[model samples]
Structure formats: C-alpha cells, structure tokens
Target: MEGISTLLSYILPGHSRSVTADYQFLQQSWLPTMHFQASLPRLPVPKLEDTCKKYLTTQKTILSPEEFQQTARNVDEFQLKEGPQLHQKLIEIDAENKHTSYISEPWFDMYLSDRRPLPINFNPYMIFYQEKNAAYNSPLVKATNIVISSARFLRALRAGLLEPQIFHMNKKKSDTKLFRVVTRILPSRIATYGAYLFKAFPLDMSQFENLFGTTRIPEIGKDRITKDPNARHVLVMRRGYFYTFDILNEDGSIRSPHEIASCINSILNDPREPNLCPIGILTTTERNQWAQNRRHLVDIGNADVFRKIDTATFLLILDDDLVSEDFPVLVRHFLHSDGCNRWFDKSFSLIITGKGWSGINFEHSWGDGVAVLRFCQDMKIDVSMRPHFHPEEQAHLPSSSPDVEKLDFKIDDVVMESVNRALKEYKHWTLERLTTKHLLHNIFNKKQCKNAGVSPDAIMQLSFQLALYKLEKRAVATYESCSTSAFKHGRTETVRSFTEQTKALCKAIVERGTSNVNNKEYKKMMIECSKTHAMLTKEAAMGQGFDRHLFMLKRIWQKYYDGEPPAIFKDPAFTKLNENILSTSTLNASVVMGGGFGPVVEHGYGIGYMIDDTDLSIRLAVASYKHNRDASEYIASLISAFEDIERILLSE
Candidate 1:
C-alpha cells in the first residue's frame, strides 16, 4: 500500500493541492494538527527496470553517443545482475521498518556524514518582505512582534491546536468550516479519507516538531540533532555576546511583549565591545575541526553555557549592520553574514537587522524549506494582523523577575587560537571565492505563463536550460527540488529538469537566433517541453521518480557488498548526471522578498527564484574560484532566455 494516495494524486491531477495561498484558516480548524499522520502512505520505490530506463533517458540529453552507448551497456548489465538483488534487499528492509520511509535513514546519514562546513555548503536564508507601514519596520517593534507571534505558533502546535497542513485542490469546497466540522467527527484513522473526499491532501507534520527548540550538535564523524522542548527561554546574540532569558512563563503563556522588547533593547544598547575572539565563528569551520574545538570548550567548563544555548526555544540574532537596498548585498548578509554574530548550528536563527529588515538563516540537516516557509508565512501574517508593540511604544523597564542575563564563557588560550583560525578560514572561504547576482525581470511572470497555457514552473526551468545553452552551448545535469510531503515522513525528490524536449527547444533557439524560420515550431516545442516537465514534476512528487530509488540501491551495494560495486554505479555518466551544474528551487509567497543558497558544486550555480504576477525574481550564486565562472554573464543570459521564451509564447 505504499504511495497509494500519491499514485491517486498523480492519476487524478485535478485533486492535487497547492500551498501558495495563505493558510489563515489554520487558526479556525477543529482537528488536531497530527490527525492525518497515521493514514498517510509511505514513499514508494520505483521498479528496477523503470529506474534504469529513466536513468538512461536523463543521460541521453547530456551524454555523447559513444558515452551514452557505454553507459547503456553498463546500466543493462547492472539491471540484469546486481540491481534486482539490491533493490529486493531494500524492499525487505523497508518492509521491516514499517514506521518510516525507505529514504529517511539514508537521507539522514547522507547529510550527517558530510564533513564540510555548514555556512555555504548547508545553511540557506529566506528574507521576508519589509512591512507595509514604515513604523512597523523599527527593529525593536519588529523583534518584539516576531517573538510574541512565534510563541503563539509554538503553543498552538504543542497543544495540538495548530491546523494540520493540507493541500486543498478546491478551496471553496475543501477549505471551508463545514469541511473541517465533518472531518473533526471522523475517526483519526480515517481523517485523511475525509480529506480525500473533500479533495484536500494532508501533508506530513513530522518536520514541524523540529522547527523549534532544536540544534545540531557537531561530532567528530556525524552531527546529531538535540531538542529540549521543555526549555522556555530564547537565545539572543549581539556583538558576539550571548544572552538568554525566558519568553514563556510558568503557565506556558507568552510573557509581556513590552518585557521582551526591553530585554532586546538593553542587549542592543549594551556598551560592551565585540569579543576579540567570538566563539560563534567556530561553527563556520569544518565539521570535524569544530567538533574537536567543541570538546575543548567542554573541557574548559563551558558545558552549562553551551547547554543553555543549545536548548533555547530558538535563536534571535540582533545584527548591528543596517539593511542594504542592493539585493545581492542583502542576500550575502542574510545567507552567511560576517560569521561572528551567527550561530550556524541552531535549527534556525531569526535575524533582525539594525533597520528592522529580518529573515531566517536555517541549518538544513533537520529539514527542508517547506517547514521553514510555513513558519515564515504564518509569522508574517500573525504580526501583520495582530501586532503586540507599536512603533511609538517604548519598551517597559524590566522588573526583578525577568531580567536578561549575559552568558560569559571562560575560554583559555587554546580556544582563542581555534577561534582565530576559524575566523581566518571563514573569511578566506566566503569573501574570496563566492559571487551572487540578482535579477528582477518585469517582462513576464506566472500570469503570462498561465495565459499561454504552460506550467509556470516549467517556463522558468526551461528558461534556465536555454540560458545555460546560450552561455555554454551544452546541456548539463540540472536539479529542481520537488517536495514529497504528501507521504508519511517525506523529504524531497530530485526533478531532473533537463529533458529531451528541453534540449530540442534550446537547440532550436540557439541555432535560429532572431530569425522567424521556425516560430510555429518553437511554440510547439515550448508547449511540449512544458508538458514533459510537468509530468516529471508530478512523478517526482508522487514518490515514483528513479533518482532516490537508484541512490538507495547503490547505497545498499556499498554497505552490504564487500567487493567492487556494480558497473552502473561506476559509469562516468552517472557521476556527470549527479554533478548538478544548475541547482534550482522555487518558493513563491506573498511575504518572501527572495532567498538563496551557495553553489553545491564549486563551479556551478545555485539559483532560487520566485514567480510573481508581473515579474520573476531570481537570486544566483556561484563560486568564482580563479575567475572560472561569471555571475554577471549568466544573469544576462537568463534575462535574454526569459525574453526569448516570452517571444515564443506570444508568437502567432
């Protein structure tokens, strides 16, 4: 019964759900947030032959004929030999572990086993759009409101009062109060069935548990996640100093907003100069090195302070720098910062700039963008609708009970040396190699794509293919993240956007240039490419994609077999297909100004984009080591590609 609902979602495309619209109705739901967990289906594994076929198809667009033939032979041999046995073993293991998805444990191991530093390699940032009212943009006021609103969200979630996250295909019918009332009366086991009857699909809420009071603890080999849900305080960092104070009272109710504001203000105004050796910078170093330094800190009697910082409800960083109007510069700030004021190990840091511009820089090991996006969306709406502090209001002076306490670590010479080394490495790594460029193209957007009868996401992805072709005259392996949250304990799937249709479209555009030799042909190719991309996206979302299945089979071969692995795993095409030269993701929300991450590969580009009514926002980052890559040229190509796409769409 694995992926039954997911398969149905694919079969009945009209019944699929979207999460773009605001979910204010969550505040009015009658059912518990986890009511649909038990009924959610497990992520399914695709058949071995289907996995091999899909693998060959993906390689065809990027590989030469000779290379493709060699790879096909290897794949055929593996499919007939080791692939079946390994896949069968995986299925058996998955059957024994009926409580979770097949990919969950290996996925966790994949992230935890990485020895790279977390900043550019793992952590990503999402910035919120500025408030409409100028007064609400005050740092103190915004920080206060965020604290209060976040506490409300936490309380609702812990008490099972937060509405379960569901995708409603027909909001008018499925997202109504009557639907909720009917669903509340159904048994917990059948709650999902009730939702299906209403054409709403509930998402797995397991990741929500780690959205708060969670921190990644660095170890020698692999990092681990630690959560202290009972802790009531929030950790605050400013000018390289750490502070902790309670935000929730004995009754589990949020404290006075004015009090929270005052404590933050005091820390902001504190005259203590920045620490000469800020310990937070150590987290930006290599994981194994950071782990060794952490052990030293514990040996030096800083364990209690470390525990407090780890167990806090969440971290709030009060940055001294004012927000920049330049989009790329602001992205740089939110993404990694100076490394001194950011504790990159926290589950997520709510950062408020001096001018009140704010966003979240999150550690990516525990979860993906879906959970964080929901938190951001809900927080944005809550603060806008029900603000606790006004712009004209002043923070009330703190009384004897809830004063903020600054945490002081007793560090010796060795720790200071480690901090200095870490700072040097971080500065060299971030400041020297990476470059980011942003584009806000106003020529066309989702509305135009829809009016032209094409998938908006496909249009953007096709533009990427065209852009890369124009720049490099080749099609490379590209990655687009597709969420699989419709299943139990779902994470993500790789949507291989470079397809045979996309390659044809790119070749036609590049070869024809501005001539109208094949205008009708171009339009036909565009539509076909969109349809193919849509099919791939749906398959990836339904847990029927081949990437993860093949990955897990290879993992089993490596872990269980002692001798040399299968030939398919050793093929050069396999390595090239996983290189991911153009790594892309889309998160379009009313409140998100834009967001991005660093390039996964040293010479590749990491693109985060959002489609709006009249424009598209793209943030592109690359590691320009030795000036091998040009961010500006790639951005120009993207703009031209988008214009070319628009011309084809509007062609008669």
Candidate 2:
C-alpha cells in the first residue's frame, strides 16, 4: 500500500513534475517561504576612504564653492582622525554578528527614538486600484474579502506553503517548474545556489515575520514592537469605537466569507454614536504625551483591553464617510483619516470607506514598503480571482456564530480631557499644517524612457531634480529609497539622486530654452546623468552606499565619544545634506493607484510617484510652515520638466 501511494504521487497531476512547470501551479504548491534566508549573503561594509570621497562629492553639488571647500577640509580631517577607528569597530562588529546586517539595529533605533506623531510625520499610505467588478467594490463585500484573503495569506505563511519572494532576471528560464522542483528538494543551506545557477535571486524574508501580529508600542523615550503569533482575531474600528472578533476557527481554518461579512455588518450597523472619548485619537498625539496618557489608562485598569488590541493579527478600519472623486481628497482620506477612527500604532490598518475605496495606512517603524507591498499585491490577486461574496449578497449567520465584542475602555475626566486635546491637535495638524497635491501626467512613460536607452526610474529622478531646480533656483539634497532586502536582515539605503551631471542638465534647460538648447549635446548630458543615477541606485541596493555607512559612523561617534562630534559632523553642509528637502520614492506596481507621505523636514517636500506604460502619477505633500514651499506650484514645475526632458529625448 505504501509503495502504491508513493508511485501514485509521481503520476498524479498536482504532484507530477511536468505539471509543476506551470508557474501558477508552482506558486500554489508548497514551497518553504523562508528557505532562502539561511544562504542569503551578508550586507557589506564599505571602505572609509570610499565613503569620505563620496561624501565630499555629494556636498559639492549642493553647497557654494567656499562651503564645499570647508566641508572637504572637515571630511579630510575626519578621515585622518577618528574615522578609521570607527570603521574598524564597525567591521569587527559585523564579523562577530553573522546573522544580521549592521544597519538593522541602528535603523530601528532611528525610527523608534523619533518623538513626532505617527500620522503625517512617519506613517505612509498606499491606495489599492479600484476593483474591476463594481459588485466587489461594495464596502461589506470588500471588507469581507480582505479579511478572508488576509487570513489565507497568514495561514500560508505560517504553514510554509507560501512561495518565497524571488527576482527572476530571465523569467523564461528561471521561473519554470523544473527550477521550482530542483530548488525545493535542495537543502536550505545551499538552496540559493540552485537559484543563482538559474540567474534568479531570493530576497531576505526576515521582515515577513513582523508583517502580521505586530504593534508599535509607544513608550516615553523609545517605542518597541510587540508581536503575538498565537492571536487569531483581528481588531476592528468603526465610528471611533474598537472591536475584535476571531477570523480564524478553532481548527485553524479561516471563517467563511458569509460569517465574516455578518460580523462586520454587525459592527457597521451598531447604534453607538461615535465615541466622544475615542481612545484611538490618543495614538495620533505626540509619542511621549501618548505614553503618559497610556500609563494613566493602565493605572485606571484598561490593561486587558489594551492587550487585546496590541496582540491582534492586524487592524481593519470601517470609515463612515464616502471618499470623494477628487484625487487629492482621496489621498488625504487614506494618508491620514480624520484621526478619530485610526490606531496608527498597528503594523498596518486596512481602511475601507463608505464607497468601498480601500488602502493601507501603516506604522513605519516595523518595516519598509517591500513587505507591505508584497502583501498588498498578493491580497489584491486573491480578492480579485476568488471573491467569496457578490455585491448584493446579504450576510447571514447561524445563531452559533460568535458575536464581535466592543472594547469598552475605562476612562475618567483626565482621559476625556486628553481625548479632547488630542482631537483638536490632530485636526489642526492634518488640516492646517500638511497639504497634498496629485498629478497624473499622461504624455509619456516607460516605453518612451526605454526607447531612449535610459531607465524609467532614472528619468523620474531626473525630472524631480529639474523640477526642484526650476522652482527653487538651485539644487537641494534629495533622497530616493533603495531596498537592501537582497541581503540578510536588510532595510533600506539612501540613493542620493541629486548629482552634478543632473544639475548641469537642469541648468542648461532652465537658462537656455528647449528651442535654443543644443539637442545633441544636451541628449548626451541627459544620458550621462541617467547612467550616473543608475550606478548610484545599484550601489545603494547592494548595500555599498556611503550614506548608511556615514550615518552609522556618526551614530557611533555620538554614543561612544566624549564631548562633541567630529568637525565633519558639525559642518553646515553636512546638516543641509541630511535634511533631505526633496524626499522621493517610487512604487510601480499595477495593484497600487498612488501613495504619499509627509515631508521629512519642516520646509521639505515628500514626493511619491509611479510610472506606467503610457503615463506618470505623482503625489506631493508639504508642510504649511514653509510659506515658500507650495505643493501645487511644485507639481506644475514637475509637469513642465517632463515636457522639457521629452523634447530633449525626441529631438533629431
């Protein structure tokens, strides 16, 4: 009997090697989600001299000649003095710790120690493209699908059946059934070799563990992340009230879609007029003040309720307002809601508005966009392909179905007063201080970029440089995030997009109009700028960038040294470069409509863009404190810059 069973396994359609050749089948089959982690390479530490040279090179593009000279001297002095010792220490630390990257601890520290509120200052948002079928876009239908699909994702992840995330350079060869079968049988220690042989690379999966069942717990000075792997329920918020109900059954199976929808319908239909002392509003307050208020809640016996919230699989927000068709208004709703119905501390909150527009508002400290975006892509695919309920389907449940429990927080006059203050502050912060503008450029996109023999991302970065240079009359420090997830325990590295090559091109276009510009010479310069930007992006992605290395070294100086930082750290140019006046990031996934974050500095702009086959989408946000910085005007400049660059590319 055993022999027959084994023989049948080889002959069955699902288990046959030939059947596995279908990429879709391979994805659905069992593949250890973290099998590649053991063999993933460690992130390298760059040389001290290389870092010093790059630092000076970046400063030269942004500073005046005299300022650049002083900064160069300071960098040279630091290179000769304390730099070597710090670099050596960092190397030794890396050598001793083979399990993680050098930047992991310090990166976590940098995010956790920040005292600003999470909504605008830290948390970022991404909206899902509307569903193709209008029925699936119903609030109840969408919410039910999200819950069901999320549970499937969580279950697959825990059971080790989820496909490992891989980058296939040549999909025709590497993304085949033969490659999957071969890699599956190999031991975890050397499985990556099989992938490398096929020119495929598996990314670090360490961050996936924190994607679910995690919360950013606010403390006085520094917050910490806490997770409960055993939590089977999800926290739900509606009209500023908190509730929880189990989404997973006792046998470890996901609840039926009808049952889940019934539970959500109960919460949505609850007659509780919006909570006057909404506890969630406190999460939007400054971190330290929230910490104090949290302590008071604990002192007054709300610890059990807090525990339920902090340990849930994730949070789902049911918004009472319908989203506006205006792009900027839609962005504002998802980026940071009215601040009353959001618990921004959750690893992420899946928000569904009345009209059924959905997106994610996530806490930034736990992880970067790589993990969150992957989750979003998978959820979107699942919800679209295998939807469990229809638009007009009514939710029905048996009497045995469990009821959702509302979290009744014990509050007093002090807590109510804090809630009032928090509401006022949140409204002022979101409405008055931070503003957003959206641009959808339909002129040209990826095909045009490639036909001109340049990367689409490089073109976008160059457009940003030209736009800012046109608006501000000078180049400022810019940041483009490059994921370092190809290595173990990696987060992100800064790709400084503003280069001398880009600056020169922007100068020519601004000073001499496109009609007067020399097309041949300008095209050569544009290509050179694109090439340079590509090199910077590659270096940053491979963890060989100078920014993280220098950042870590300066942190060591402050923590270990006695009095003041080195001369290089004190330079005005150094401070200005780190300010990141033009912070930019790009996510070009079909599942995402648009995304944005608030400015990093008071007078800066946060730009999130996506480039498709025929158009470009941009979301720009800025703080009101800088009277000179207008998001709308900057967007206008970006549009003009794209037109100017297109002419340079298309010229004979």
Candidate 3:
C-alpha cells in the first residue's frame, strides 16, 4: 500500500509545490519587510491579557487628558453649519471625521490602472495578495466609495476637531458606486432592497483617519481640547447582533458562527419556547415564553425576515459544547431584518441613538447598518438589570477562536474539493465564494489598524504573523488575519472655526452638479501634486509612516485641506483629488467577522442604521475549519478587548 504522504500527494497534487511557493511568497514578498518571520517560528502574541491591557491603557487615555480638556472649554451644540438639504446636513455631520484630501495614491493606482498608459496597467490585484475576487460587486462599490472620499471630498475638507458633548457618532463616506445617498436612505429603497450601509461606524480608524485626513488623535495627556474642557459623556449604541457557529463540547460549547446559529435554532424553534424572538425584536427583554430565549435564529420561509416574535430566524450549522473556557466562535454574521413594521420600516434609514432606545426600529424599512451598535447593545439589555458581572463575564472581549492545524494537510486536491464544495453546496453561503481565499491561504493577510500610532505596514505584518501562527498551530485566536489599512484624505490641522471644518466627499457623489467651488480644491491639489511628487520619496513616505500622516496632514499637507494656503496643491491644468474623511465607510472588520463565520451567506446595509435603539451592541463571528480545535481561551481574548475598552472607559 502507498504511504500516507503518497495518498496526500494524490489528494493534493500541488502539495510539495505549495510548500515552496508559500515560502517564496512569504520570504521574497512579505518577509523581507518583517525579518522575524523567515528566521523565527510564528511570531509570538504578547500574553493575551498583558497585550490587551496595554491596548487598553491607550483606550482609557483616549478621552481623559488635555485634548479633551481643551476641547471641553468652549463646547458648541453640534450646530448644522450647512442648512438642511437633508443630505447636506448628513455630509457636514459626517465630514467632521475626515482629515485630509481623500485621494489615496494606491487606490488611485487601482482605479486608473486601465486608463493609465503603458507598463503601469494597474495590476488590478491587491498590491499585497492575489487580486481580490472580481465577482463581488463589493470591491467595485468599495472602489467608488473610496475614491469619492479619497479623490473628491477628502482633498478639500476644513480642518479642526469637534469633541461632541453628546454623541458617539462615527461618520463614513458612501461609495460613489452605491445608490445615491438620498435615494439610499429613502424609506422606499430601504423597504425592498439591500442594506444601503456597510460595517460603517465601529470606531474603525483607517477609514476614519483617511477621510478625516489627519494624524491620530494625540493622547489626551499629550494634547488638549480647549479651556474648561467638559468631560464628554461616553455614548454607547447597539449596532446589530453578530453570529458565529460551534461544536458541542465537554468543558463548554465550542461555538463558531455556524454553531451559534444552531444553538439559537434549537432554543428558538423549540415549540415549547413558543414566542422567543430574534436579536432585533426586543432591544430590551419585554416578551418571551422562556427567560433565556435564544434569539438570532433562522426562519426557513420564502422571503423570510426577522421579527419581534420570530425566534426561529437564527440558525446554526454547527454544534455546541456543554462548557466553554471562552466565548464560543460564531459561524454566522448578522443582518438587519427585512420584516414588516416591527423590523425595518420599509424605508432604508439609520436609527439615531439616544437615552431612550427606539422601540419601533425592528420594522423592515427602519434598518440599514446604523442600528447595529444599538441592536447589539440591546442584546445585553438584560445585563443591566443583573448588572453584577462574574469574573468570567467580566473577562468578555471581542475576539475569535480560529482553527490552526489544517495547514498540515496541504492545499491538495482534497482541500480544494472541500472548498469548492463549500461554494457550490453550502446553502447559506453569504460571501461571494471561498475559492480565492482558499488559494491565498498562504499569501496576503492583514488586520484592522486600530491605533493611529502604529504604521500600516507594521500592522499588516503583525496580521501576517498572526495568520502564520494559526497556519502553524500557534495562534491563540480565531482570526487567521485581520484587515489592517488606513485612509488618505486631503489634509489639515487648524480648527479655528466651523467654516474650517472638514468637507464630506460623499456630498459630491450624492449630489451631482456640485458647485465649482469644491472643484477649485481639486485644481489646487493638481498644482500641489507636482511638488508632492518632488518631495514625496518612497523612503520618506516609509518614514512619515501611517502614524505621521496623522500629524503631517496638519503640518505638511495643509494645502489640500479646505482652508489652507490655496496654491499649495494647485496646478495650472487638472484638478487634483479633494480628499476628506466624510463620505465613506468600509467592511474590512465586518468582513473579518464574516470570515470568522467560515462563510458569509448574505449581508445587508451599506451606510445607515436602526433608529430609537439600544446603547450597546454585540457581534458574533464563527469559523468552521475541518476540526474544532479547542478554542475557548482564544475566543475569550476578543471579548476581552471589548471589555477592556468598556472597563477602561467606565473606570475613567
């Protein structure tokens, strides 16, 4: 009989070859930048608790110091600088987050690739990995949205920061590729169509920095808000219920997106439970046949939608364990309801959060992405009543339990067949397909760069190391990788007045025929480009790094900012990008959540949220690999990040 290696060869014809390819790709392509990978074993994660504590130290300091104090001195009620052209109002509110000119050189390279003359035919590939699958309209839409912010509004925004005394608002630019913003939020379009929103406002920094076009907010200890800085109230909102699956276990359930759904399914569909609803129906526990109702299940009916009484909406494709050492994985990702008045109100809209969470938001038209934080917060609605936290519950954070041993099997025909089968047969596939990622299993990888202090490349490298660790059986978390990136808007630093506030690039995309006034800003950048090119050496960029962008945007890129010295970026002919932070959003983190779920079957919303909602939101992401590697501890880390963020904020 042939040896096991021989059988694997047959199962995976490309086995021996992939090992070389994976190494070459890593060593030549990725490792040169981060030498540790080639020479060392998988990079080590700091003791999860310690690393988390470190990350939390900064989190706790975000609003405590001088910057907060300085800004606190003269607080202005968030005044609408521009009168109500409803969409314009959204733009002004949203634009405040952006920092510089929106045009990102790399993204521009991606966009203008075809149009560019000669050898530079844009690779049409992720500069880091294989070209992202062209199948999903997501990338295209993403490109459009990114450009609107990067190219148009990002370049021309006003400068200055607003420390709102009231809301924890996160505004992002809409992809120019999406339906018109006004049309998107229209109750009509929202009622029957897709989510006009995406994984928008979750304190996502890359997109925020790019649109806002500034350096990371200096630590409060290092900066100041203004005189008599008033301690801003920390505002929390539920976004939506996220999901994951798991396998039944001994110590506890080994949940992933799939298993979570299954658990919710069993409890929700139990006829004895009678009326337990899904995540959205009850922002707070009001009605349920059983006390611990498992909401977030699935309803099999055609045109199935989530609702107040529909506990069967959530579904799980994996099993659960009896005792979990950590948070179980989530196989399924969350989606807002398409149900009648009790869910979305037939109008695509964002739910504005406040002291009293809205009760009427679960209706179909009322949803989009905006309500997730609130919806998620609502899931823990019952927690406040029983507010006391056990040590384990207190350890809660947002993380995952990615299975790591599968790489030993090789990218042989066997694995390919399983993945292919996943695409063709997986009934609940929400993402585009599993083919490309399956191939790049050894290639490009990243994680979101939350701290503005870190370099983007460093962030990507860390994510790469994490992926490697998981592939090599050393990862402590479910995330094989994360999406680490930043946005590049125009620029600015002076917050002299409201007129000096940032502009929303989305405005241009939303309202065609924008005045030439905004057009001037782009022209100015064209002029600056000539000099920017002269001064911007690739090495200098590496030095300025992502963190410096936060500061250079203020000191160096001022020309591109809304009210800076006008001629800095201007040229005689073409209008350069007028970048701004407003007018954009991305789903990289949300996509990560989806990936954690093993497969993404469907997604809803692009830019809006639920109205009259809860204060905190919960997300559940699951991963389904060939086996359930005991992962409770790793999954717990993610929950730890969340709690760390929450606790730090509370203690402050």
Candidate 4:
C-alpha cells in the first residue's frame, strides 16, 4: 500500500494545496517602480521599395554577377506585382493591431514552433568565475547565499522595483549618422520595449509542504510544468537528490540570508537515497517523445501529482565542485542531465558549484538572453554584496523547520527501459553530438578596432567571414541577431552579415597573406565592410531590418494568394541566400555575465562572442551529427583570421 501510494504520488497532475499571504501586503508590494512597458512605441513597418533595394544590394556580395542579375529580375517583378499588395495587407494588419507589429505574431510562432530539444540546441548557459576566497566555497554556503540573493531579485522583479534597463546612443561613437541628435531624441528607452518581465513557473508540491513545495517531474513526452499560485519555495538538486524548502516567511517577507543558509545546512546533513526514477532526464528528450511518455505515466496512477510537479516557481541546482576552472569541465556538468542534476524544462536554472563559481541554463522559449542577462547581473550583484555564511552559525537556528519532501517514484521494468533509452539518446545528443569551444584570444579588442577606423562588430564579423571562407572555400549566408528591443515587444531581426565588402575583404585575405595585406585597396575594403555592417546594425536596431519584413511579406503571400508559390519564393537564389550557414550573435556580455547558445541549423555553427579592452573571447558550438562540421578547426581558423586582420591593420 505504501509503494502504491508512492507510485500514485509520481503520476498525479493536480493537487488541492493552497498557500496564503496577506492580501494587503501583496497589493502594496506590487508597486510599479519600473514601468518597462509604459508608453513604449510599436515597431513601424519598413517601406517595400527600400526593403527590396536593400535585399538586392546585400545579395550582390554573396551571389555571382549572373546569379545577382537573376535575383535582381526576381526582385523587380516581386516589387511591381505581389509586393505592393502584400505591403498593403501588412499595413492593414499593423493598423488593426496597434499594440504590436504585424510580424510579431509570426516571429513568436516561429520561435515556439522550432521544437528543438533544449540542452545543446536551444537552452544556453551563462558561466560565472568564482571569487578567490575559499571560505564562501562550501556547497551549503553557496546554495543558501544564492537562494537569498535570487529570492531578493525575484521579489524585486515582482514589485517592479528592479530599475528598467535603458539604452542611449553615444555621440562620439555612433553606429549611424545623426547619432548625436538621435541620442537626444531617444532618451532612455526600455529593452524589449513594453514587454514586462514574465515569470513562468514549472508546478505544486505536497499539501503538507505548501510554501516550499515545487516539483520537477518527468513524464513520457514534454514533461509537465505547473506551479501553485502562492508557493514561495525553490527546487534544489545535488548529487541526483532533490530538496525543496521555503524561502519566504508566512507573512510573505523573504527569509534572512542566515535563515536560508541554515535550511541548506539541514538539507545537506539529511541522508537520502539516489534518485531511482531520475525523471528529469525525460526533459532532455525531444518534446514529442516526452509528451507521449507523460501520457503513459499519468495513465499509470497519480495524474494530479504529475501536474503539480510541472509548475514550480524556478529551479536551482547545487553542482559538485571542480578542481580546475576549465570551460569544458564546467559546461559538461553545467548542462549535463543524465542522472546527476536538473530538470532542464524550467524557464531558468541557476547552477552553483561547491567551489562558488556559478552559471545559468535557461529555456530559450521563455525569453531572449538579454532579459535573463539582466536577471543574472542582479543575482551576481546581490551575491557579492551579502556577507559569507559561517558553518558555526547553523548551531543558532530555528529548531522546528518546514518539511522537505524526498519524492519517491515507483518504477516498473517498463519505466526502467524507458529511462535507459532516454539516457542513451541524451548522452549522444549532449556528450557525442554537441561540441563546444571557448577561445580567449589575446588579440586587439574594441580599442584596436576603433583605432583602425572600424567598428568592433564589423571587425569581429569580417573575421568570421574570413574564417568561413577559409573552411568552406566560399561565402555562406550568415544570420546575426540584431535586437529590435527599442520598440514595444520587439524581439530580434536578422542582420544579414554577409555583404559585398565582406566578400572583398575575404578575397584580399585569401589572395594576400597577412604580412602583405596592408595595401590601400585592402584597407579601404576592410573599412567599407565595417561601415556596411554598422549601417545594417543601426537599421536593424531601429526596427527597419530586411529579413523580418520579407518574412512577413512571404507569410502574407501564403495567406492571400490561393495559388502556387510565387516566382520570388521559388528562386534558387532566394532559398540559397536565406540558408543560415553561420548563425552568430554578439552577446557583448559584461565581466559579471557570460552567455552561450547552440546553432540554429544542424550543419551551421552557433557563435557567441564578447570583446573586452585587449581580449576577444568566443564560445562556438556545432552539431556533431555531421562528421565534417569541425568546430575546433573553425576556431583555429577564426583565431588565425583575427590575428591576420590585426597584423594587416598594424603593419603600416
């Protein structure tokens, strides 16, 4: 009967658990200190002719003269015939929905429908190097400190007390012309403008464990994510064991850092069996498979329990300490979910090691890296500000504590078979298929590029072009993410990184070695490439990018035109130009926060880079399914290319 009850606990979907806080307290706490969404401007649709012209101009650099002419003809016909009608339709839709751009729904749909597994494909982790002091390195100390800091950040977020981020253009170093006036006109605008910080919870806990009960359960297919409306606990995983404890007092105030530290100490001292179910591994599987498995599990017994476990406020993992602070070692355990740690389905998972270094792996579907980065920065600042927790302090703590549930699963032979299968698949996807490279180059950084009459973005991009050309022997259509957060609910636009100037620069590097590449012609071409990149970046930032406009137009065509695909859509050049062979983003992380993500396309490389005073650091990822996609070789080329570019500029 006890085993059956435990089995029933694992499969349930919903629970009748209620937690209460003072209504007046919550009402007063919901103060809007940061009105991130107030008076935010909506994205304006781009002019059809201008978009068409820019599209042709960008393609000229990538395609051959003959190919360019064919594309040019296609563009002209599209502009004259279908483009006008599509533009009108978009305008109508934009007018009808004044709150968001016509393309916003499509963009949102595109992201949600991607259906990629989280680990190496979508969810990216931010790595934080630990402080030198050894006293704050204990697992319990780090865990409790992190919880207190994180809880504070969460409370701040809920109350809108966290100051909204604002971006202003620089006069001395503007990416576009009229930057001085633009800076004055724009003032301080919120990012993802008009978009509030969304709080997504993954589910409920046992009735006895109300406030501190959040569960992360694995089903057959897409694991369940649910949260009780009033729960104030965090889920913690360490050594394949899960523990939940309340961080909030009954009156709704957050517990003191010391109190949280005591709870962590108590948790660490408690003996627990290894996770027999290891249900979190199911999250690492493909969504469809997981969803199917979930249905099977629910049918077995506790449907309500499974649903409750699905919705937790957030997830926290206390990982094992590593001796060396290598990227590979950190990243391996940071993202690994086979059996050791984590239910990867949460909106964000904060991973802290016993060594004190920490990082985050988050589901990309919830929000972009920028939003999460802000949250991370807040946590880092909070943690650094707080004093260290001493182990001796555990003696002077509360005697009676909130109950921490050790969730047990009744696993039959069938379930064990499924677990083994998931383990095999997850191992291949993470350990075998995905390859990561973190390069810390001691080359010229932002300052050097500025001195060389180029934007840092342009130089970084040009280096990638050169590297790709070296590896693949030709240019590939590159998609660089440009934030459109200047406008309300603005997400990202594709800044077509490949250009005629980039091709020219690549050609110069290939034809002339680094020592002899300092000619006036080559220098001119390099600067031009940088200028072109800068212009596109500025345009994209202003919500006037080419790709999103074209994407919306194509969707409109599909919606209105009740016939076969148009000539523009069928053009081989059109298909070839949009293939994202090199998907990259300049995350531009600060010293406090660093983010890394996987490739969008299977055969392409996902590159996240950051530039500092005298250094350039990059995290490169490629799918290992393709035997030929050598990320290490590409990194080598990237290093060589950047070195050559630096040498060429300094040679004269």
lDDT of 3 by residue, 404-496 (tens): 111011133433443344323332222322111111111111211112222223222122222223333221111111111111221111110
* Deviation in Å, model 1, residue 576 alpha carbon: 1.2
How much lDDT does each candidate structure score?
Answer: 0.83, 0.83, 0.21, 0.64
- Estimate TM-scores for all models: 0.94, 0.94, 0.20, 0.82
Candidate 3 vs candidate 4: the lDDT winner is 4
Whose TM-score is higher: candidate 1's or candidate 3's?
1
Scored by Cα lDDT, where does model 3 land?
A: 0.21
- Indicate the TM-score of model 3: 0.20
The best-first sequence of candidates by lDDT reads 2, 1, 4, 3
Q: Is candidate 2 or candidate 3 better by lDDT?
A: 2
Tell how far residue 624 is off in model 3, in angstroms: 9.0
Kindly report which residue stretches of model 1 are placed more than 4 angstroms away from their true locations once superposed: 1-28, 395-402, 614-626
Pick by lDDT: 1 or 4, better one: 1
Q: Per-residue lDDT for 148-186 in model 4, tens only?
A: 666665555554444444553342343233432333243
Model 1: what TM-score?
0.94
